[model samples]
Target: MFDSMDEERPTASEPAVRRSRSLFEKHGLRATRQRIGLAKLLFSKGNRHVTADALAVEAHAARMTASLATVYNVLNLFAQVGLIRSLAIEGTKTIFDTNTSDHGHFFFEDTGEVCDIATDEIKFAGDLEPPEGYEIVAVDVVVRLRPKSGSVPFSA
Candidate 1:
């Protein structure tokens, strides 16, 4: 049964907005219209992953004439600020994530769809250690994909 403590957790949406602003401020980033708009697009629903091409389409649909270069720039800025994470989805293109927390990803082999897998669900074996003074900052796991239909999936 779910306990009252579990029921009281804040909705995921709240943190995205709060974190967006805080991150911008923390990084001394100017709160430009383009930046805020992009932040909302990336984090509005709270840490969902998306591709640059997909985001460009969404921006275009919103009547925002942002060039691909601009999109890339903003993405890089966001990434630098730790406001989002980026991953190169195997057999596809790079994707952006608003969830900055440590986590793993899963690629639906049949659909080429990428999704986050809980970090706790992943177990590492062996005594692999980071070389002397180096620290393991982050880990990214990408699952290569293929469609079961025996037909190639469309790429963006």
Candidate 2:
């Protein structure tokens, strides 16, 4: 929402702010100025995904006055509380997702972008078997996509 080209963005309410602060406390994280600033910038936009770099940029623009390192630290805090989930786009670039549920994503190859795939749009089929002393966990699907016209050719 912060770095996106969307014309409008949603805002978080005072109650949400209070809840966010409480969440930090619940997770044993200090409700510092920087943490609160980043939380407000993040939750205010509703359920959306954003890269850490993009979030750092937005935090500064919003007058949060936090460094990239600090942003990553704060993000890790929220993630620990189950407020967000991280999706590794590929071998590099981890995107922080707000909607912490079982769902797939569509990765745009053209712009290296991603968005959640509606739950009813796709179906999953698999039989998981865990070895002894191991437990089967969640299954995440990442469907990579190329532009309809055609994928861009190689560059020099």
Q: Return the TM-score for each candidate structure.
A: 0.73, 0.77
Compose the digit string of candidate 1's lDDT tens values, residues 1-156: 012222222346566445556557767898777776776676556557887788888888888878877888899887776667888776447788877666777777666677777767875422558899997777777656565576767442
| Model 2 alpha-carbon miss at residue 3, Å | 24
lDDT of 2 by residue, 1-156 (tens): 122312222333346556656666766777888887887788677777888899999987887789999998878767766667778887878888877766888887767778888878865534666789987454578888775665563221
Show the colliding residue pairs in model 2: none
Task: Report the CA-based lDDT of candidate 2 relative to the real structure.
Answer: 0.72
Residue 11: error of model 2 in Å?
A: 8.8
| Top TM-score hit | 2
Clashing pairs in 1: none
Error of 2 at 15 (Å): 4.0
Q: State the lDDT at 13 in candidate 2.
A: 34
Q: How far off is residue 59 in model 1, in Å?
A: 1.5
Which regions of candidate 1 deviate over 4 angstroms?
1-22, 124-127, 145-156
State the displacement of the C-alpha of residue 100, model 1, in Å, after optimal TM-score superposition: 1.5
Candidate 1 residue-wise lDDT at 41: 75
